[model samples]
Target: MFLAVGLGNPGTRFERTRHNAGFRVVDILAERLGVPWKSEDRFSWARGVVGDKTLYLLKPLTFMNLSGEGLLAFFAHHGCAFEELIVIHDELDFPPGVVRIKIGGGVAGHRGLQSIVEALGREDFVRVRVGIGKPERRELVVDHVLGVPEKEESIILEAAEKRAAEAVLCIVEWGVQRAMNVFNAREENGQKEAC
Candidate 1:
């Protein structure tokens, strides 16, 4: 069983925020996956089955900063190592719609990832980061992450989530290395367009 976690906070109020991009990716993964996910035993997440594999596509309900609260325990319970886990989250530093995948990298000041590292006591897992666009105002990082994306920005979201959904399928169907090659290192950086 591979654990694919899309990290984000709970609540309808945060539905369209850049911070919730992870949640959007999870929904996409569910929709396009070859196999279906049925209600199964899970914690702070949802379980879906696909192609002889059982996957846990989770959206952390513990808010951004405390994402690992449930995942760490869940990992241990199932004897799944940190390597078997794949995390998806939003990145404000990169342009919107860009997806970056890497293994064992620092959080780059993301509190949620920091929390997850602390909970798991390691940073050797796969991370699928959806770039949600750079901050217009540097000091407003918190607000920007939590703020809702604008109507014009919806296109960026669409592109990034679509890529992320494909990345998830790749990760499960192929492997981390293959997914990284296809998802990351894209020829275009979310198809950068003039503002």
Candidate 2:
């Protein structure tokens, strides 16, 4: 079974934050797949499935800094191979409307991803980098990412997520490269194709 994990802090407070993009995608996955995502405190996870794939939908209660603990335990408990794992998280490097799906790249100062790499004991797993873009000013970086997108911007963000969900399907069914090619396409002036 393929293991799909979305990275985000768990709680009502984080529900609408841009930094919680991963969690939002997880919700999308749950709805699209009709997965009964039960709250599993034992695994520190929300467990479910999509298609024939067994999905371990997770929101780390350990907060963003220590996400590895939950991820490692989940893998160990399920006996899931490293190849079966895929993580979806946000990236500050790309514009808000884009998503980058690649295999084994640097974490680029993302502590959450850094923690995952450290705990996974490998650097080759696939990552779906959903871009929220860079902040206008360095001082506002945290607030910008963690804060909710304004109503107008929310349209673009939701479009990004819908595309992301499809990309996740392609990644799981085909492979990362195929998904990358299919999902990474843009219009002449640079906008994602319709979902």
Error of 2 at 169 (Å): 0.7
> After superposing candidate 1, which stretches have Cα over 4 Å from the reference?
33-43, 76-83, 187-195
Best by TM-score: 2
| Model 2 pairs whose backbones collide | none
TM-score of each: 0.84, 0.87
Q: Which residue pairs overlap in candidate 1's backbone?
A: 37-48, 37-49
Which lDDT tens digits does candidate 1 get at residues 1-195?
A: 778888787778988888888888888877766444433233455567656677777766677888887576566555664236888899877888778778888998988788889988999988889988777778988888898888878887878888887777677767888777766656254332211
Give lDDT tens digits, candidate 2, residues 1-195: 666677787788888788778777877877887766655442345455555556556655566767787776676666665356778888898888677788897888887888888987777878877888888898998898788888977888788877777777777677777777767764223645433
Lowest-sum lDDT 10-residue window in model 2: 186-195
